[model samples]
Target: MKLSLFLVSTAGLWVAANANSVNNKQTKNDVCTHPFVDINGRCLFVNNFAQMDWDAARAFCAGFQGDLVTLDEANLLADIVDFIYKEGLTDRSYWIGGSAGAQTGAFVWPDGSLVRMGTPCWGVLDNIQRPGAEPNEKCIALNKDNFFFFDNFNCEGEISVICEYKFQRENRWAEGGCATMKSSAVFVFLAAALLGSDGATEAGSHVKTDVCTHPFVDINGRCLFVNNFAQMDWDAARDFCAGFQGDLVTLDEANLLADIVEFISKEGLTERSYWIGGSDRALEGEWTWTDGSSVRMGTPTWGANGQNQQPTGGSEENCVGLDNANFFFFNDFPCVTAMSLICELKL
Candidate 1:
């Protein structure tokens, strides 16, 4: 019997809950680095934090000595989605390696494998031409806006990235021999490679940058921003942050609660509530951050409700916010309630 792992020549694919838990059928020995987890024989990095354009996304992956992930394997999509959801990328799309810009109508991966297009692979659309027929939407993406299935997206659209690394580097990259790029992205990747030849910036830049940019305040060691001006509902607040490649703030750090509260208080902003990205909308009372991390409850985190406790509103208050009524500690509130927001930029 020929040895194979995760390479399925079939149309049907299953959605897995964890990348490592998938039935990827192969002998294992390859160990991936931090952030890149081993799935079958492949090392995959699901970059849910930083959002970049398709070309920039590929370049970012190249920084890690990898390339934008290729979904040639049937079970890989399932595994990738499993990792994405686990990372709390339920609201973001992702740029992959496949593009039809090379052949116009034909889509292929960096490895020259034909980009699969079908029901379980591509999301439902009027005309499913795999890499899509739209001239503008040449880059392939697992679009979160369109049910996390393959969708041809605009090359310039900024979204998340799924980087793939291999022990045998010959499987990917433009220099591997065959011409795989869609068009200008090929040159972009080469330029980035040439620029990185001197090794000034390491591949670790994929996760988090050292310094926070404008609008994002550097608090102690973290990057955060308080939108004390615009009042929006919980959903709208999150979407607003998404535009900035960020999301609603999560008081994850020990000193974040005290520092941020004090900062906003000095701005005279704590007098009004601010959305802070904790919600039990998926499951009532099970509060979690957008990335699926459990929100640390009680103690100095959540506020009190009279003689009871905060989060007293139950399902009606699925969304969480920093309430001034409770001295700016955490409090559950209706998701529709308009409140100014606190954003955390991952980029």
Candidate 2:
């Protein structure tokens, strides 16, 4: 009688443990139905209110607990349009992850996934072609004039931003590999958790942690300078700076100019006039950016007739070159001077 009673107790305990395990599995499966926040089955709405560069916008989204807008699934497009209308984003344009930044032909999202947008679909019937249109390049923007519409803007242009959160991928294991060894070894070496894609190690499979690094780094994390140029034309310099995840430096304030001056002074780039984008080539006496935006020469950081000098008698200071001392005025340096210009991109 005693032996039979012990056997019954052991069997009952085993059944209860198994039942609990089954219930836990069902709960985990049910939770997988929701992708992420504000997103119903892989759709989300994001609205922007500030003008920023493509890179700047991406950074904003990452901080918003989301990644830069990626047009992958069909529902995402519809959600974005609805958000734009609801939020009344008719002030200016915004940027999405359609640009080939820092690299070309390889367009990837902030998460390093390939860009995948469905057939060209715009909310409005605007004749303007977006990034995927004929003669298309990778770069999309939210246009304000055409509310609920998108167009292809230059990747370097500053605009507002939006982002969407994505779900972490579920990992799995394959057969006939080193996965078996990892599982058995986990108990033996319990000091450290050997992390793998699906909690199992396999040959030729690399497990990666979700670590994000900034593309641009500086000594003080404020101003970034690219100081590697021998002799390239202004156009070539601009291209080189853009390639470095930045553009020819634009000075919006005196402090920004001071930062550049400090950077140049530290680098000992004296006696060389670097090319900047402050050329009045298209319009005389009226400064404009390469992207064709009005530039207000806020304050003179130079002596009288410093940047105001039209050396070429063309009625415009087409190119800018740095001089010594607190005089931060730019002269009409020839485009072919090949001086190293500064490139400042949004982080």
Candidate 3:
């Protein structure tokens, strides 16, 4: 009878262990579902059920406790594009978190970070178009038709959306219904638990460090030097930057421009015009950066109105300078015209 009791007890223990294993597996699976796909440690949801305008699409993502996906890294964006292609979505455009806001051409993420422009971030001619002669395209979308290269579109235009939320290990639970919990609240709790009271990492925590040379301020992962020493013409300014193993600053992204503006304001240099690295000297009406990338013209890049507007001097003005007269909006000026300069170097 004792032997029989021992066998039954062992059987019960085994069954309990099996049930626990099954519960754990189910909890893992429940962390993500349907539209939400696990990608590079983040949970991303592609919503194609309804087409909505940019504002509406943003609201929809917010309702799910997520925001429109912001692609700061090129590799991350490529991964998302690949995921979309694998899912057989090759004909739809999905709204992302980039927009020019009140100032056109200065594209920024929803969180106010600069969206890297040109090359891999933007689609080729076939995939992206400016829509009209005017600078009215304020919103950005991922074009599946063009391999998911980002394209600027009208904000009012209806389109699908992609939402993103961070995935935390502690949030996974079989019986806690964590999937229905608000993402913001989960993030707060997780951050507190992981970071602890001191807000410093514990011993053996991995950290990343970056350093910049003297006189060059680190701005959004880039080293920038605003030359306050002297004012010179565009050609001389280019030579000045070349001396320091850099080039005249290229305001390719909106946030970069905003940072420069803020810096100027802080330094009391609001009235000084600065020479930037954009010119149409090679081909009239075709503005290109020092790196030979074509410039996305209009709106924030140009002055808001009146005589301060861009390319105002026509062929006579071949170089671009950030004019303080019109709140630092770029204006085409003669290459020989004297102005302060801004330089940039990659970290």
Candidate 1's TM-score reads 0.42
Name the top lDDT candidate: 1
Q: Report residue 60 deviation for candidate 1 (angstroms).
A: 0.8
Give candidates' CA RMSD values in order: 22.3, 24.7, 17.4
Model 1 superposed RMSD (Cα): 22.3
Per residue, candidate 1 scores C-alpha lDDT tens digits across 52-112 of 9988988888887889987664345645565565555678788888887465567777766
Q: Evaluated with TM-score, which candidate comes out highest?
A: 3
* Tens digit of per-residue lDDT, candidate 3, span 145-191: 44465677888989888886533223532111101112221110112
Clashes of each: 0, 2, 0
User: Candidate 3's C-alpha lDDT?
Assistant: 0.60
TM-scores of the models, in the order given: 0.42, 0.33, 0.44
For residue 321, model 2's alpha carbon misses the true position, in angstroms, by 2.8
Model 1 accuracy (lDDT, Cα): 0.62
For candidate 2, write residues 88-197 as lDDT tens digits. 55465667655554555545555455543212223222322234443343566655544433456666677766555433222422111101111221111122321211
Question: How many clashing residue pairs, candidate 1?
Answer: 0
Tell me the whole-model lDDT of each prediction, alpha carbons only: 0.62, 0.43, 0.60
Displacement of residue 87 (Cα, Å) in model 1 is 3.1
Task: Please give the distance, in angstroms, between residue 122's alpha carbon in candidate 2 and its true position after superposition.
Answer: 53
